[model samples]
Target: MHTSAANELKSESLELLREYYQFPSAELRNRLVQLNLGLVRKEAHHWVNQCTESYEDLLQVGCMGLIRAIERFDIAKGHAFSSFAIPYIRGEIQHYLRDKGSPVRIPRRWQTLQHQATMLTRQLQVQLNRQPTDQEIAAALEISVAEWQEIKLAFRNRAPLSLDAPMHEDDDSSASLADLVPDNRYQSFQLAQEDRIRLQQALVQLEKRTREVLEFVFLYDLTQKETAERLGISAVTVSRRVKSGLKLLKKIMVGSSS
Candidate 1:
């Protein structure tokens, strides 16, 4: 399907669902039941090997979750339907795993360490406006820096692998995560070069007076009044010119993007 048509259909479906949910008529409820069942079936299909339960059994369990979500949904809370549905869906899936006694548990020590690390990182970021360093994380987690290092080392090769994350193909058609990470060193060098080129281009685009005003205000870190005095213009005129020049530059940049 064309992207536009698909988007339209999705929008229409959501609108219809919202209307049905609000009214809660028999017909609307039936439609919701069918949709919930279909969603369960679709999710079950993806977990055939991982799940010992039959698809029908999984579907029934998932429907219980779907009903709970529907009953608890509050339009006044201003959350999307999918956001509210996720917890219900995950709960159902987890219950299935627990019932089957899946042997995929993380080590208890690792789980404790992971929880502590995560909480510490979040707290540090809230306080410092940046991610915590290893030393800071260790202090927050009440562990020695060496112990923290050891814990990190243990999990270094055990990172959760996201199947959907992008990978790069080699010339011989092999893929790797190395290609997905931004080449920060190379990108920084390119960015510096690009900024220099853009500044030169902007200067060329501006009138001499405007360029001089910008140079004094930016490069020399002069106040608008100082820049205005240097250019023999009022501060207001200097401000207006700077604003106009910025708008022009923004247009140029946006145009380049397109």
Candidate 2:
């Protein structure tokens, strides 16, 4: 609420932070967090321009940064907490913005490679006096040609997108990229064969009527009424069959799992 300025109490606050390490109390930790809100505000101001999120949201993220910094700070390191905590605070905000800003959730491995390859390319270009070749880039980055190609794809997907209305007020275009692009859902790389086997075993145990209901309701994605009409049964009968089938199916699966 009314914290002493971080600058004014640098030494005193550092001591308070070390005290936090000893006692490990949330009240003290929160008090330290309040005192260090200035750091969060300062870092939030710096990132406000680069990020598309509202300044208020950025500040909230920055406060998360501050809290993390407080949690991880070590008094035994003998460095100023400001110097130590700045990276954690900045990193927290950057990480939050990175996730918030990206339309695609790029895998962590690729994210690391993106940084590595970008940094490597810049260094190689300067060192070699030209743009690096795929061979040269791969060699320096210690990745094979196929891996390098996948890295290239990841770099493309990781590019930033703006949430602002796609078409400008003056534009007459009917379709934006959102209209043009198809959303891709993530697919598991492999089916669990054992699980599939277990499911089949479970399905085999269902009664003929119940299995038929399940097949129509799920495999064909038919409504209960439609399934009933197709099966020459009342909708209530179809509903009962489906309910009983799922219950039996769950029992079989649970037994199999155990």
Candidate 3:
């Protein structure tokens, strides 16, 4: 399907899903579910034809993705659930395919480097409360910085393997993390949440008066006149405090993150 047509369909589907989610009558939910199923089948049918996996299996995985998309969607953000859900659905299907196919054996040296990098990254984050710098990563992994850089360069050259490789013939629904790409968008959300938390914490560390001015002006959405009256200050004084408090808070947040 054309991107425009797909987006329009997704938007329409999200609207229907939102209405069903808000009201949550079984009849309405069932109707919407059926509608979504038809849409999933249409998309999945095209994909399944190109792969060895059964169409029914792909449909089942797609349904799981749809259910997840409905549950996680936030209407306040003004994003269509379908747009967010497509990647999730595709990931799940790709996972299924990888689990059912033959695996490519990665070379021992590359596997070791990959494992070391992952472990060092995790250890650095735990100790420093953030992702490690290149030097930190190298030190933690007991490698020279130059060697670490070379390993990273070499790792980038290899193409990633498929996730749909089966563990064994009998296993139908299991896939390894090796089969999946990290969702960079999800990583960005995690970083944003951490930054927001750090900022809020830094705000709490401000002087009581400064914090109060900020809360009154921003959190409570008060006008300068109302804030002045509440705090027994002139409007001019209130505006100055708000500005000073904001500048201080920004400094504090930046300092804490660094």
By TM-score, the best candidate is 2
Predict model 3's lDDT versus the native.
0.58
lDDT per residue, candidate 2, 139-177, as tens digits? 877879777876665454233322112222213323222
Give the Cα RMSD of candidate 1. Answer: 22.9
Candidates in order have lDDT scores of: 0.56, 0.61, 0.58
- lDDT tens readout by residue for model 1, 80-181: 555455446545665666668753334567569878898877787678755467799888778889878766644532333221222111122222222222
By lDDT, the candidates rank as 2, 3, 1
**Candidate number achieving the greatest lDDT relative to the actual structure:** 2
Which model, 2 or 3, shows the larger TM-score? 2
Q: Which segments of model 2 are wrong by more than 4 Å?
A: 1-7, 102-258
- Indicate the worst ten consecutive residues by lDDT in candidate 2: 161-170
Those runs of model 3 whose alpha carbons end farther than 4 Å from true positions after fitting are 1-14, 25-27, 102-258
Q: Which pairs, if any, clash in model 3?
A: 97-164, 98-163, 98-164, 98-165, 99-164, 99-165, 99-166, 101-166
Provide TM-scores for the models: 0.35, 0.38, 0.35
The TM-score ranking, best first, is: 2, 1, 3
